[model samples]
Target: MNEHAVDILTELRDLVREFVRERDWEKFHTPKNLAVSLSVEAAELLEPFQWLATGENGELSAAKLDHVRHEAADVFIYLIGLADRLDIDLSSAVREKIAMNRAKYPAEKVRGDARKYTDYD
Candidate 1:
């Protein structure tokens, strides 16, 4: 089966809703708690590279890579859950942010360059 065959965010939202309803977890899934959970999961996702020395490539075994994948999925799941709880349309937000970033880093000046937006054009 194809992993990307479905609308993952919508499926995640439904699953979260069912989970919350089953466990009466809505009260505990407040925005504050969700934000904290998201941050913790994000940190977990970063664990594989956390101790890499500067300019050193971090390497991981297959099991470690699997762990990283799971952690990353957890972070995204929690983020979508939080967005559903708050009635936020995450896709729209991402689109708007991309537009904002394009304005900040216009291709005409930044194309093929690795400089920060504040650097000389």
Candidate 2:
């Protein structure tokens, strides 16, 4: 096992690219297919919390948490793979979105509130 784990998102993207190059999988990795896979993986990640009510503490066993972690990893892996396939820069996009969110929800208005950005005064 590799003790030193590389950046997971970058590793996943590189793995996908290498697989595509080795097996010609790019022909099947269309935007629509990737989008559907992304949604499916996201749904898998949400499955563990499906029964939990809002603001309720759900019972998640260690095994269940492990399963959730795997599902979440799958979701992220597919997302980065899709981004790589589409030539999108995920890091820059995330930074840009965070900047936009900061402008939308200044700390003074949302300091301790859990309200939506639009609901903030």
Candidate 3:
């Protein structure tokens, strides 16, 4: 992470850490288990988007949107827990990934195209 980047993740991570510590649930929150939990939460988050046609308006009712938000939060929280257990720096990882993607899909070559990098030729 860059020095100028906000330190918001630390606070959120600590909150998750404290919540786990208080519940004495660390024993059950193994890296593998956390990864599984994160995936499960992600699947749950996808529930709100299911059964929609390709052109269907994604806007949902207020209550259903709230449900989506809660499920999405569960996915994020579990991901933070998994990353904490794995000692992964998500900010740096994301930044590096974005850089790599930019290299793979240069604007000049990829402009107005949706092809894969391997198909650029």
Candidate 4:
């Protein structure tokens, strides 16, 4: 990832820490709570597209898109908080996951296919 992106994440992490500290919410930000909160926010993110056939096409009304944007931010915030509590570097973790996925789903073997890697065997 670019340095700018890493810097932004660091800035966000610090912002979240300050926000939590100011609110005296550190006691409530246990890894389990953050994990559950992350899941809840992620589920909320799907609400805008729950009944839409074209949801997969990225076609959402402006209002629905705005709702999704906020929900996505919530999910992202909780994710950052969770990573912070665990001392995990989000960017590096993402890079490692991408590398692992590339090995599991090689472009030549999985072109235009959406099946799991094990399904091909």
Q: What is the C-alpha RMSD of each candidate to the true structure, in Å?
A: 3.9, 4.4, 2.3, 1.3
lDDT of 3 by residue, 10-58 (tens): 7778999999999999999999999899889888877767775541345
Q: Tens-digit lDDT track for model 2 on 1-121? A: 1223336556777877787779987888887888899899888877777666641335776766887889887787778778887888787788789999999888877888888987755
Question: lDDT value for candidate 3?
Answer: 0.84
- lDDT, model 1: 0.81
lDDT of 2 at 13: 79
Q: Flag clash pairs in model 1.
A: none
**Could you give the candidate ranking by TM-score, starting with the highest?**
4, 3, 1, 2
For each candidate, the alpha-carbon lDDT, in order, equals 0.81, 0.77, 0.84, 0.96
Task: Please give the distance, in angstroms, between residue 50's alpha carbon in candidate 1 and its true position after superposition.
Answer: 2.5
Cα misplacement distance, residue 40 of candidate 3 (Å): 0.7
**Ten contiguous residues with the weakest lDDT in model 4:** 50-59
Q: What's the number of clashes in each of the models? A: 0, 0, 0, 0
Q: For candidate 4, lDDT tens digit of each residue in 19-109?
A: 9999999999999999999999999999999879877546798889899889999999999999999999999999999999999999999
Q: In candidate 4, how many Å is residue 33 off? A: 0.2
Best of the two (3, 4) by TM-score: 4
Clash pairs, candidate 4, are none
Compared to the true structure, candidate 4 yields what TM-score? Answer: 0.96
